[model samples]
Target chain A: MDQKRKDSASRSRRRFLTDSTAIIGGAVAAAAAPAGALADDKAPSNGNLPPNVPEWMKAPGADVGSQPYGTPSPFEKNVIRNIPKNQPQYTSSASRTPIQDLDGIITPNGLFYERHHGGIPEIDPAQHRLMIHGLVDKPLVLTVEDVRRFPSQSRIHFLECSGNPSYTAMKGKTASDLVGLVSCGEWTGVPLKILLQEAGIKPGAKWVIAEGADAAAMTRSIPIEKCLDDAMIVYSQNGERLRPAQGYPLRVFLPGFEGNMNIKWVRRLHITDEPVYSREETSKYTDLLPSGKARQFTFYMEAKSIITRPSGTQKIEKGFNEITGIAWSGHGKIAKVDVSVDGGKSWKAATLQEPVLTRALTRFRLPWTWDGSPVVIMSRATDETGYVQPSFEELTKPRGLNSFYHNNAIMRWQIAANGEVTNGNA
Target chain B: MATLKVAFAAAMLSLGMSATASAQTHYGIGRPATAAEIAGWNIDINREGTNLPPGSGNVAHGREVFEAQCSSCHGNKGEGGIGDKLVGGQGTLASAKPIKTVGSYWPYATTLFDYIRRAMPLNAPQSLSNDDVYALSAYLLSLNGIVPDTATLDAKSLAAIKMPNRDGFVADPRPDVKDKRCMKDCKP
Candidate 1:
């Protein structure tokens, strides 16, 4: 390391140590590279070996104000959301996080998966207004400042697109390609019930229609019961203000619901007696069954889990390897996750990491000794509701293969004799 | 379900506390919305044609608007160029290549009007007039062989038309998968 880099690293190290207790979910796990080990193979290219004075120690660094806002280290450039190449012309599309590259439960703000309708809208917070009308005693219009004035609450939760695992059933897909559509974050906002109470909802109000201010003016009808039950109008994501792609200024946060129901760029809430049955809810998110019948208002994303390390596109040595992954449920906390190294013939419970929060991504890990033979590794997550992650066969048996949304099947990664891992079904 | 009950209890407790707090001194947070402001943005139209604007359009006018504004993405014949294929795929839902087009899978005709009104023409969303949206819906429906080219679609007619898959949707019947948490002999 050069003098400037050394100084900066030391400063960061000091701050990291001091801010340990104040640190939120998965920050410590994110920084969990053993100090002595070089994170990359390129460490040999630079003459910064042990007993030699590092190059970064020879010069002074740039001033702090040089960058008004900081970004992740350049070494972490590979951690990115990957948009599939097929939908280049569809303005409203989704991109997946590189879940295979992540270390812990909390997805970094930059790498969080994005699913937008009518593209991302750049809204001026000053000009924006959130209107609450219909079936309310007081139809109020709240400014961004007025929204922040309410008593705030912060909660860590996971958001998954209901259509996440649909496109990955085909052969030859990577782990990130399979399960990268889900992400976790520490979301900060005011509880939605407080505002709804202030609005004085009418006795007959059953649904709350949340509308985004994007070009699509995207709309979804949420049950008023769910709104009072842990829904939040969030302004900040992770530790900072949300990225524009992640709905800057504000969004409706329905904990554990499908990502679309947690409407982004939110600006209006119209309480009504019935669901709007919008295009998304009826034509898109609904699950079609083998009987030609579809299931609508399937808001919850259900319990799901996927192994990240040694997943597809990764090669491993045939010895001691740690099988680590994340599991979460829209219903509630992940109660337990079982790992099946020999396909599903036998299973072992993985150790759940600390701070396993309700409806948040919980990290799970287990040690396995590879016998230098081909074997399939899979994980089954059981939520607090006692709902186990279903196999692809089990899922398709009831809902059929025609449904495009809510495919929360257990993913299987096959380890080859040559020490490469791939999707078993794929 | 128990979690939902617990959350409801918490919400009630918080609401009670805030109600007492409001009694002492009002936060006086948000301003009351004006009638004009409400009328300007409250543009949602339900399946009952509750909030649709007064408009009427024909297939001929719809073809003209779609070509001018939507052809870049939806193709000239609504066969899909860059956007999703809008026609065909009827009765293919149970087949191997089940293409979910506007005609094949959509459960409601109002959804077609609603989606086009709010989020269609990809590049210029919400840029279509209510009449143009009605025209577009007529044209698309005609292409799907659901309506005649001579038919004019207004709010009432649009809501009245039943979609091909109108009765295809069922309510969610969950807890579909059952497991006994076996540690051994899990798979035979």
Candidate 2:
């Protein structure tokens, strides 16, 4: 099976190269073609190569409902989320999406990154209920049906784990290993504000503690302002029911917040005047500074970007290679991404893909000509708040390497004369 | 007819009182959670001592509970096995190897009780009684030298016991690094 997958991957890679050339050449030719010449030209192939119809053209295709639920093409099996080799335990670990292998903005439900605390719990939707109490005029229990029946809205946003970046243990790992802990999808759900208003929040309520039904009962205390701002109780992903790994029944979706705080398998929310300071916020996700003081409740994931193509482990031929990747910020939409082929010494603004939404991943691409010489390529993102992605040295100087969460430092990829790519900062 | 008019006036006055008291918005969705239902799931503890159950367990009894329920995964002394090491890592947050254990890093003692109660004993979560969770928390705290073997931990004492690193945290002040949108000549 491994060999078969490798063979298919290589075939796709070859086809991609051919298609790129065809596209570039076709663009140039079409621009120069006369308006009448374009419509009258006969296509190269007429159904078949020679005297015989193509097999697909001659045969009857499978009928409808051939696959009740659709799946990605068998040829695209290589595009998947992978659990890193250094994972401490399978029960509580993260599986990263292969960012370099994907395109555009939306992450497929099957390939979205997965972070499990005590493994995925098989929740029965019929029995699932979200209880809201404490500091509320009326304590209420909302079933899955009731939660869904509330007016719903769909918004595209990115979810990134607080521990998205590699730890000090990460020295020579690929860019995918470093920054693959994020995924984007269009989430369909009711705004948390509407729900809170329904519960009639009391005057002194300041924080709302969201708890999951997983074995860990993962909990995080979100400020009332944030909860009422853009938080959602998401039930669907990418136009379909959420995949089990992405929280099948119901989950809290906080736009522009760290992934962990967007609790999955959410079951309970208790409003209070003080932060719960759960184990996650107190012991785990809190950021430690060089002064021996840790920063608590640091929820926002800063602006960051990476060169996914021509990144670590992906080799590119010299000349005419397009450097493309994703940039995002929890604060707002990515304002711009600057690509640097010669490290930070020189940079050029890359083209931002259209329809960039707030708190969502934006794809950036830059066409470059490699000169068969060693060079360092990197991309820096700036969000609407005017926050630029910082270098590793700059980030470590303040917080130090001991800080495990929220490493949005700029990533640099080294390209060798032999067309090989490696991970590094300098 | 006079009694009927008085009754209608009383009803109107009560309705007006209720409207003024609540002054709340209602979307009219979901059922009102019964007290029993709220008690079953409302398991969170804050720094100011809210929602902690009434239970006391000493370090000695906590060791027993830890051995029986937690030892398999967290090691005999909370040193860690498949689970995270609960003791040691004190004063390591600023060092090269920051060991974030229950004793060294956790800011509040209530967090330990809340965590153990909500999710601990890896294989079977929420299986331990509130007393058992308090006991395990006490044992773990004793191992870290924060509590004495004879000391008993109840909701009041637990909330009162200060963590060593309690002062080691500050509110988030972000956008820490500054870099203008310089399109060229960025690197020094």
Candidate 3:
């Protein structure tokens, strides 16, 4: 029965891909062709399945009630965020989707990466209200409905936890095992500037204190200019209301900022003249230098790229393989992604997927023939700002060992002669 | 060449053993943390002394420490330069334009100690001793007029110290009871 289900699922997926591709091709052809060529191209026809089908295929009767809520397909039950146990009460370590195991950038909401400081807060959306107080002209209290009423916009972007690759920084580790705390999805929400405009900011409002409604009451003081710029109060992910783990009903989405700055379960936006000196901003997220002067407010995540397939854990049987992965930058669009198979000795540019927007995940793919020999693979991304992703040595050189956060170094995966994979640096 | 090969083998074997040992050991390597080590590290003191260390200090001694250690960043009178303004500007929260200095905005007294001990001095973080941290906390608190000049601040007295803006903050009551139950029914 499991085999049959698998077969059906594979067939359906193939059909979906083929049909979608054909439809897209036809649309493109029709648009490019002359007016008289319209009838020459016909839309694909749908046919009913044979009557002698499985019981599950039969239409649900009145006894089977309709479901108001939805869940992921049962076939995808195994796909889940793997949370590594540390101390009790502290879920400090977690990993997201094995992106190599999946196709397409839209990670299923259930399988999204999670990194929680305390734990996921069980927040009731109905009871959640966002208060805009402090340096605002009018301290406005907004319900979820009030937010939804505003003109909404949808954007596709990746939210990657900053501590995504701390495990692999040591080297010789598999790619996904090291830095799997990243997931990309289409986020839908209202621009934060619109709401801030509604509230009317005072002249002295330089910093805005964003506080979360959780046991930790996580808070961060974001710059007022950023709030007025591209900040989003997102409510939906991939055409559905956000999952509880992904900040349920409402979350602050600051494009280009590190994931920590994107406050989840948002409760209040206090417009203050100065920073609140929150624990996250001051102590946790701040980068401690060897010189003792810590680098605080390192908000913008620098450009970085990784070759996902033919990476650490996934095996390739010494033949033609497509090296695919994601490249993104908080600064701007990924101008180029260079992949080096022979360590950093030489580099070849990878083909970047289309529509590479600023502060968005740009997918890159490279075709390579793997001989059954030991080889090191790495990818380096250069953003529009002309800042190239540094090597681990280069990143650590100036910062020294005291540095903990914001280590966007080039990752290396070593393919042993025996086909076993290990971290190159280790 | 034979000696080099043997050395390489030994190094590889040691690497393997270390990896195995790392897998077995739960916490990262270091001496088992003593009470002194824990106390030495966990000296974070918030404005209300949420995690103040066990030590006593007075404003006079605090002022001396502040001048020697803190005055480079914060001015002599706690008027901030490169760092932050730590004193004056009280009761400015509700004004059209509020000067939200430490005296005005901070809701807890313990937060001062927490901030100072964790990352302060602008040059060296976690460098101050417990007594130094307490003195700095007292100095900052007295400068802000939260505590008297002669008042001693320690773990015991720090939590008891009331902040001016302590009552300013309120628990969020949004997504109210009405909102929670209003899914099916409307107002009569």
Candidate 4:
């Protein structure tokens, strides 16, 4: 879809949802059903139960091409992104993907959380170009077509904002509001090494400053080691040309780096000996510590996970419950995910849903019996590298709460006797 | 899954043992960039003043530009409004509410110029002349008391004006916090 249409659709979806209560009812209904609610002693039949065939089964469903590009069910209209509230401006704002409402790994392109500095730009592929210069034998300026001409590879990776969990107004917030600045998807593009090798890297080039074409002309200095390692000049997200907001024609995808340095709408790659301390690298994105020294080039996103179902806002009825969440590590694949009930007092290993791709979100689920008592529940993910996801206290001790970015702390949700789930995390 | 990952790791390790990577085969696509083309898109300015463009600006000119172009979002004195606060907040990094403005926290002066040149005025970024950006940088730096009010900045002057917090940055010392695998009766 074009930028204009995509934007309108997004706005309309948000508008319709905000004005309707059916969406809220649907969400509560969604949580109540899907396995756990099967044993509920309430009246089973409400006209659509097993005895009576649902209205949909009695009639022919919509034929193919009804929605040529395809859209989610109308009932799922409220499963849209949470636009950043009270942002300074819409152009330089970020959005939260409704992660709580999603399952599996691949984030739909339209639903991918957006973090644009200068908003989305509609770039014509024919006119767009990517330049690679500085300390290279061949300083190449390739068109989008030329970029596609090179050999390409696809990888499933999780793109997370360093400032994920930027949500501050935690009261009554859903999991989406808590840790929504992250999404996992398949990125298809030419490995940057191939392009850089074609350009022939001259010695002494230690850093590459990737520049974006948005109004901000956003730029970030990336270590040349990362650029040549697993960096990619991605054109396709999931299986399609990237949604305009997700950096249309092209963008840089550093496999495990923090999202800011990924440089969406990437236009230029300038190899240099020293890091370019851009506004982003210095004035922003850096982590301030209690020692008064800010940590620079803090690229890797550490391991993090959150219990999506029964997390915040969502309610659960007594009886058998299925606890599910997502876990990921920038270093590599997740080694294990342990879910804890009774507020971290005891833990049980959750079954990790398979094809747990590296640097991508891994789905994990565990069966539980609620017993109708109040309890605090949470999940902890240990990465393959032996780095366990830290608690808020542990996380804040070293980095401090003001560090703001890279909040990979474990989240807790309190399940009351009445089935209301609330934020147990401070 | 753990076994699968281990097998995958072993295979990667073995592959690493015999890898002689890179350009045995080039698709021969993407022609070399022209000098003019390189100059057009090459807008990044490094901390060491590598890509600083020509032209100069002063605090006086920067003040005018700030009032005209920048102050709308950054506030009258860059104390911040819709945009971020760019001045003051000096020596508050270790404090509870560290206001991390450009003067107080930014390690290099060049970052200010680069940011203003590329993304200032919010509405019309990259429209600022290099001189205007330099002037704005000088003015903001002066407001933060890092530079003299009369100081003019070109590539050299801007690079030479060592920011107060230049040494305030350290390499990322991460994996700093470790979560022990505490299953039951954990420390609360």
Ranking by TM-score: 4, 1, 2, 3
lDDT of 2 by residue, A124-147 (tens): 899999998988888889999999
DockQ of each: 0.41, 0.43, 0.02, 0.47
Q: What is the lDDT of residue B98 in candidate 4?
A: 89
For each model in turn, which proportion of the native inter-chain contacts is also found? 0.55, 0.68, 0.00, 0.72
**CA-lDDT, candidates in order:** 0.83, 0.83, 0.68, 0.84
Which candidate, 1 or 3, has the higher DockQ?
1
* Model 1: docking quality category: acceptable
List runs of model 4 lying over 4 Å from the truth.
A1-59, A166-172, B1-24
CA-RMSD of model 2: 10.3
DockQ for the candidate 1 complex? 0.41
Error of 2 at A96 (Å): 0.6
**What RMSD, rounded to one decimal, does every model reach?**
7.5, 10.3, 24.2, 8.6
- Writing each residue's lDDT as its tens digit, candidate 3 over B1-188 gives 66675566457436642111111111121122234433433332333444455678888889999999988868997998756677877755444334556676566666677666655664565577878878888888888878888978888887787777555443222111111111122121
Count of clashing residue pairs in every prediction = 8, 0, 25, 1
Q: What's the TM for model 2?
A: 0.86
lDDT of 1 by residue, B5-92 (tens): 5566457557753221211223679999999999898877777777878899999999999899888877789888767788888888
In terms of lDDT, the poorest run of 10 residues in model 4 chain A is A32-41
Residue-wise C-alpha lDDT for candidate 4, range A378-422, written one tens digit per residue: 999999999999888888888876787888888899998999998
In Å, candidate 2's interface RMSD is 3.5
> How far does residue A350 in candidate 2 sit from its true spot (Å)?
0.3
